[model samples]
Target: MQNTVSSTEAKPKKKSLKARMQKFGSFLSGMVMPNIGAFIAWGLITAIFIPGGWAPNAGLATMVKPMVTFLLPLMIGYTGGEIIAGHRGGVVGAIATMGVIVGTSTPMFIGAMIMGPLGGWLIKKWDDAVQPHIRQGFEMLVNNFAAGILGMILAILGFFIMGPIVAAASAIMGAGVNYIISVHLLPLANIFIEPAKILFLNNAINQGILTPLGLEAASHAGKSILFLLEPDPGPGLGVLLAFSIFGKGTAKASAPSAAIIHFFGGIHEIYFPYVLMKPALFLAVIAGGVTGTTVFSVMNVGLKATPSPGSIFTLLAMSPKSVSNFIGLILGVTLAAAASFIVSAIILRRDKTPDTDAASLEDATAQMSAMKSGDSSEASSENIENARDVVANYDNVKKIIFACDAGMGSSAMGASLLRDKVKKAGIDMSVTNTAINNLKDEPGLLVVTQDELADRAAQKAPNAMRIAVDNFLSSPKYDSIVLNLKARDQMDSSAAEPKPAPAAKSTPSGALDNIDFAKISEIDFLRDDDKVGTATMATSLMKDRVKKNSKAATVKSLGINDIEDDENRLVIVTPEAAKNLKTRYTNIQVFSTKDLLNSPDYDKMVSELK
Candidate 1:
């Protein structure tokens, strides 16, 4: 009896439904307020810079434009990436940021059109190719570079391919808008659709229409819908009326929060939870959406691109000349709201209160806490041993990838950092960084990224192990990460079925001694240097060989002097000679062409050869 009393005492008292609803309402308010501030900032920036009349001073433009176009997108991308992949997913997040900036600024919507899909694809690809061999030092670096290159290439390709598709999609969307206005706004349909519009359509029209066009047409057109109503109702007023009349308990609680967000914050995301809670009322929301959109279309209401979720804050950002558009917006929102409230109340009047799953909620909360503490009971020793067995029996594990957004800046830096760390630990890992969108599934792949982008990696390679890193390129603590990865790899190897070894062939050296001489001849002698001396030296060395061979006359120097001191230094050669060289050389040193240009010995050798 004492034990039972102690257990009972440990449990906290449950809050009243009213208190819970109030808390949720407060949470909604907090969430929407910051978003409103961000939307206002975006609007002000767009108004001042984006081909509009409100130009700032030249100095301000220089500072503001970069902040808005570059930094803001990057920050958003990083945040979004984190949301998807985890905290370590910043690499992919950064890439997504680059994509957004490029896509938005590039001609004919190039960056805007292709960045998201491309970034997503590259993350997936990098995850598949590099996740497995991440433990190997040299292999990790190679894989990192490969992933980066592949991501960039894929982004460019996707941009080209997706351009026409986006154009077509835009055209279709426009046509659909026209159809909805013409067919769905009839008086009979307005009975249901108008109420549905109040629930969501008003905000959609504002966000989907006005913001994209940089116009303020919706507000003005909203007046017509009001003129037709018995009490001269505004657009979203109907939704309010419906809520007042029919909403109960939580629905009633959500109504005021929705009003605050819709009216002041211009955010529509808030209403979704309410709609989800009562799916039977979804048609009501749709009805309101159609009503609002149709009314706006009929009245020729439009707005400038203010991508913030629709609320009153968005309306305030519109041009002063757009009073009519604002009026139309109000009408649409009010009408839709009233309709939804009435429909929701009517539908739910006779129904019992929906069952709440307390156990599931408690379980979810517990799991979340466990994840935070890194204490999953399911990850037991026996399971780990089994996983290792599977991995040991498996074959063809070759690559490990680190993925980010642009695949240039952050991913490259991250890859380099990871390479150094892994090397120091004496791990023979293959790691690479790529854009998130270019991933393809492969065996023996492991993916490491900022925690935010893990979801994207998982989507690409379901079987691959994903390790989250807090920092992309800098190391405060990657040692633990490496150890965790090794353990995972061992488990996977142990779990997989073993495959037969290939037939062996007798050669001059052991398999470990195998070297491709042709690769050595064509190897870039200067890849790292930025000085002209490096290029000069490499060129003089090649020239000396050419001069000595003359026709040994088939060997000719082809602009070895012309190599630049840039990031990329590719050496092209005929297939026959390349193959021969690969057969001879086991390893190659990469040098920058700049080294040759600055070398005194190269200058002397070139003179002698000449």
Candidate 2:
């Protein structure tokens, strides 16, 4: 049966909208994720250098101002530009971002994200337009001058036009947030923040908008709830905790370790795939967010600065030196976790089959032990759309890429794991990791991304086969992919080896009988009238299949006249065309197309021109 939907069937518009949102989320995450190291460094500096901090030297404290003002924003711009183009783009991006940074005391992280990519894209367009017209000898001269002039213009534009406007916008946004906090309506902000964070826009919300406001508030009051709003681990903790208890099979076993890493280690990205695996669990996160924020607001507890990775320890380390603030923070996390776990557990319980027997706890434990021992294999029937159609031409794949939120983290690790697998399998294939934003459409490519980012990956690499996984670090799908590639390689090798043709007879009194069959390297498909391209299309199809199956056959299409009298060539012709070829060139090898196409030893027939 064909795997397809009817042409008249309309795809759900809601899904399309969600996909667009996810793509935008991916773009925003890309701009911020790369600068995470800088955020961590700055977080550490702010924690130690403030007036009441452990190392509160007035001179050392002053460094924090310039660090956020210049260094962080410039790093963002450079990373954004590198994503769009390369090193040149990064240089121009940093230069352009300096203008925005100088124009205001507020951090220009969002503005830099915009200007950096814009600068790189403009230069890319210019290079695309000019490179074709440049003389070979003068190419180097033109390239350097063009980039320099373009960078200067962008820097000036950033200073004169973009800088002030973005500053005004940032001020207005900050004021709005302050008003919300002043009126004690700040907890309502979680309505928007929780959803955006789940969509992978956590960094954008935390660093781009909330951080600026929190910085101002902390400067005045020594703490602000804005710092805690986006970075709170309560919601993620709640979801993972619920999964640990209520989730089935591997999900139940894995959620405990994920919880520890998420709460303690502070890499919140680990839990994203868990929520994405069941989007309905979004409600649990939202509920958790609202509950935690409400607690924080009621208790009037806030952090001194934004926590970089949102770890519980870091959040505590950055908290104001007060007992009530500490209690409130702990209470908020506990209540949110309780709320989210309650809701998620209910959802999971409802999803379970009423008639199906639950796995025994002992059996579940043993299964997990087996998985840890490397005895587990990926089940083929995992949930994915158009799985067969996606890999319909699996043999054509020459490249495979893994894409993730931060190109450096999970995607890079996944690519490395798969590369090791391919190396051990002795396959000649290229496997690598790239940011989803940096990917472009190419033939003969396969892209693997987490389920949440799969839509964005498809849009970026439209021609490539795409496989979506619930988790990059531990997916069973890779096993199936490896098996498929190995099978294709084996089939191709077997098909390429030469085989004896069926028509063995005593030598006849003809020039063709003396011709050596072993010398033939090229095979031609002779056609009569291809005026309508019927023969051309057929020849292309035949050639592709033959090439995939054979190692040495240089297949080609030819009109009778185009057939060369080379000793190393053999031709397949239709029944009518064979009469003319056989009469005119008795020394040249020829076979009927019907005979070759119908032959049982297809690989042997291809090799021997049967």
User: TM-scores of all models?
Assistant: 0.38, 0.66
Error of 1 at 356 (Å): 16
- Quote model 1's TM-score: 0.38
* Predicted model with the maximum lDDT: 2
* Candidate 1 C-alpha lDDT tens digits along 1-610: 1100111122333554533433333222222222334535644655565443267455544544455455544444444334334433434545544633454332222233234333544565566776776775676576557546654654455445544454455456545544554675433445553343323233223222223222111112311222122111223333444554565543454466455544565333334444555566666655565556556666665443343434455444543235566677667656655665566667666557753322343232322322321421122111232333322312233566776432333456567777776665445778787655455556667566544344445555556545554445333324334443444444344446385222111122112122222233232432211222343355456656646644121111222212221222223232222322222122221221222334333333223221
1-610, model 2: which lDDT tens digit per residue? 1111111221333347767665666666676666666765666677677776667778888878787778877887887777777987777777778877776666787678778888778878888898999988998899888878887887888888898888788778778877776677887778788878777667657765677567656655667888888888888898899889888766777899889878887767778877877888888888888899889988988887777668899889878767899999999988888888888888888885442222654333333322321321122221213333322346678899888765655577678778887776677889998877788777777788876676666567666667777677766556556645654565455457576222212122222444366877776666543221444455576676677765576777665434555656666655555544442232356655443334333355454542
Off by over 4 Å in 1: 1-40, 48-117, 120-124, 131-140, 175-287, 306-309, 318-320, 338-610
RMSD versus native structure for model 1: 28.0
Quote the lDDT for 467 in model 2. 74
Model 1: lDDT to the true structure: 0.41
Scanning candidate 2 in windows of ten residues, the lowest lDDT window is 1-10
Leading candidate by TM-score: 2
